[model samples]
Target: MTETLRKKYRWDRIGLVLGGLAIFSFGLAAWVAPEEEQVGSVLEHPNNAELPESIPALRVQEIQTEKAKEPELDEVVLPCSCNRNVLKLAKNPYSDHRRAARNLPNSFFVKDSNELNAGKRNGKLVEVKDGRGFHISALSHSHAVLLPEVKALLEDLGNDFADLLVGTPSEGTRIRVTSLTRTVKQQNRLGRRNYNAIDEASTHSYGASFDIAFTDRPDNAADCSAPTRAIQQVLSQYQKSKRILVIPELSCMHVTLRP
Candidate 1:
């Protein structure tokens, strides 16, 4: 072959090889680039811009963002059960009628009149005849009986009465017991005169309930209500402590022992 023709052929081969290498380098660059930066084999884009959404990926991101933005919920609490009145009057929360007698302690119920009468015969009861610290009601329920424990309760209440009367003109005044133990028959008879008589669960039959007289004067005299307020305060303290339940009636405080 001639020298010039051979040189031209060599140069042509060299150009072909260089062009192939350039094409290969561009393809490799596109393969190694991030998916967001590569649109197609020939196209490239800046990574700083947001890409168009794929349907599945977009839904997943939206769900994640919603979960993060949602508020967390809090736990809830319940209320107490005792919430009704007994005497058709405004309920004394101290003596909530919702209480079930089925769960009451054994000492709280007399079971039947026979058991109460047995208590009287067994000296488990004591006569609360009028004496130094208290007075009995003038009503037909004059002969009142109480459990020994309850009699002791009255004696302890005398101290509360004294504390109430402290620095007052009525200091050392005796408290009056308005009602005491009643037979089932007595309770049934009294039910006619009193609407609060519940023979089945009556603590009076058990010798565990008692009534004290109170009067509120609109005049608001100092120490005039000390007896009434003091007794009520003491009874309320006991009621809050869960030792007894007190019903603040129109004219008296009816108390029942926890036992």
Candidate 2:
């Protein structure tokens, strides 16, 4: 009876150990296995994966948040009031302006940016900035520069313009110089769009001309009449004196420094 009881106890112990081993192996398999939905979700966001893109992105924004640049005051063309009814000044043709422009001291056709830079370095051209009487507009197709004589003429004109309106409501009015020296390339480009570029070549390429588009008032203290009359008087005096040639264009007054 004792021998049979020992045999049964040994068999029972072996069976219990085998059952525990099977349960542990099944639990480990369940823990290691992943669902199909989990793998698809991970693939959707490749950027969040272990590696970056092999090919770089083109036209990708350098800055995530950047403001658009705003245009300058001179970049925008203002409406002009100078015409037959207003100002009523003498009108010079592009022919006359070009003729005078071509005859200036050491005058030569400025064909490109290289010539322009050489002119500036050798004193053929002088830099022009916003001064007392006139403020240079933000030039897109032109440069803020002129011949020494032309710059002097511009300064004188500004002084006279301010003097004329002394004690008047338009005392602080300023002439808006819209255009100045331009390269031949710039002229050719403008000619396609600007009817005023009627001449085969523009005087602006010689740094001998400028355009006045508006008489900017300091305040609304007075109407444009006073300022308009002042422009008429000054421009007329200069034109009659043969000091400067003028072209009364639809949008602006083109003034050339006479040779």
TM-scores for all candidates: the values are 0.52, 0.67
Q: Which numbered prediction scores highest in lDDT against the true structure? A: 2
lDDT of 2 by residue, 138-208 (tens): 88999998998999889988889899988998887888898898897788788877776657678998888
Q: For candidate 1, what is the lDDT?
A: 0.60
> On a 0 to 100 scale, what is the lDDT of residue 58 in model 2?
22
* Cα lDDT listed for each candidate: 0.60, 0.80
Worst 10 residues of 2 by lDDT: 58-67
Clashes of each: 1, 1
Write the residue-wise lDDT of candidate 1 on 72-126 in tens digits: 3211111111112212223344334315222333344454567666777878667
